[model samples]
Target: MRLFHFSEECSIERFVPRVKANRTNMPPVVWAIDEEHEFTFFFPRKCPRIVYTRSEGLTEADNHLFFGLTSCNIVITVETGWYDRIKKVSIYRYELPAESFQLFDETAGYYISTETITPLSVQTLTNPLDLLMARDIEVRFTSNLHPLREAILQSSLTDFGIHQFNQASAQ
Candidate 1:
């Protein structure tokens, strides 16, 4: 199982365990993504996005509503404002050793380690939007992600991640 950590910073020699904003009550831990859901981080950090897949239990109606005519199994939606940034910014994909990490969220493909560690290797992704296109992942840009967020929250699309909601546009 390959584990990865994505960041905008190029030279991160060491990864220290730090408490995430949402995980404040828990102990500090280093987070990494498994191979399956690595696409979720294929953008600038905090670039509000809604990444989802058509999982087994997804209802046809809900799938039609959310996915529409897209043939891609996965869809990543962000706002128009982040388009330039997505096209220009470089993301560093750090390959981390998985020996010390344990699964944190299976669905989200997140693994957590309580100890600090060094990356096995690092690769820079120059064009994030292009990577999505190359992988046959549909990228949707809108004026705001609120509507999509509301729909997914009430829909049967349980296999989804709405990241950095507060960072999304109001309108």
Candidate 2:
């Protein structure tokens, strides 16, 4: 599969990881990042659908899955394959604009612009097929202000103020 971030000038790169299946063949699956941690899993050929989530309790539609440049607001397009048959497959594309999100977060506050890339792998097959599913996927978000960033910096400053006060009391 090919992924392009508009902020990256639509440069497509391979995000799927190399795998060894039965010492010869390999399969494709979905890849994503959760809480700054990387995860790879297999996608079923029949369904070939995967949803990524930032929080644990969110549903598939509620998940914040954005794609774009890492820092700027730019649109992105993703093209992947869909299963048509065991030997034949079809391609589907999805396009999202950078201005789609109203908010984003880096530390605690949300930003308007961000990008993330991940690799993917696959396991288990109902039948021996050479179909390529979306094994790896990248998500980029573009926004004006990041809520997470604000939260982290604010917490850091609060802790620093407390530490300074403690030092003065000791003296």
Using TM-score as the measure, which candidate wins?
1
Write candidate 2's Cα lDDT for 19-120 as tens digits.
324224423322222222111111222322222223334333323223213231221111133223323422222122323222332332222223332312
The RMSD of every model to the true structure, in order and in angstroms, is 0.9, 20.9
How many residue pairs of model 2 clash at the backbone? 29
Q: Model 1: residues >4 Å from true position, as ranges?
A: none
The whole-model lDDT of each prediction reads 0.92, 0.25
Q: State the weakest 10-residue window (summed lDDT) of model 2.
A: 158-167
TM-score of each model, in listed order: 0.97, 0.17
What are the per-residue Cα lDDT tens digits for candidate 1 across 1-171? Answer: 999999999999989999999878989999999988898999889899999988887898998998899899899999999999999999999999999999999999999999999999999989888888898999999998999888898888879998998899886
Q: Which residue segments of model 2 deviate by more than 4 Å?
A: 1-86, 102-171
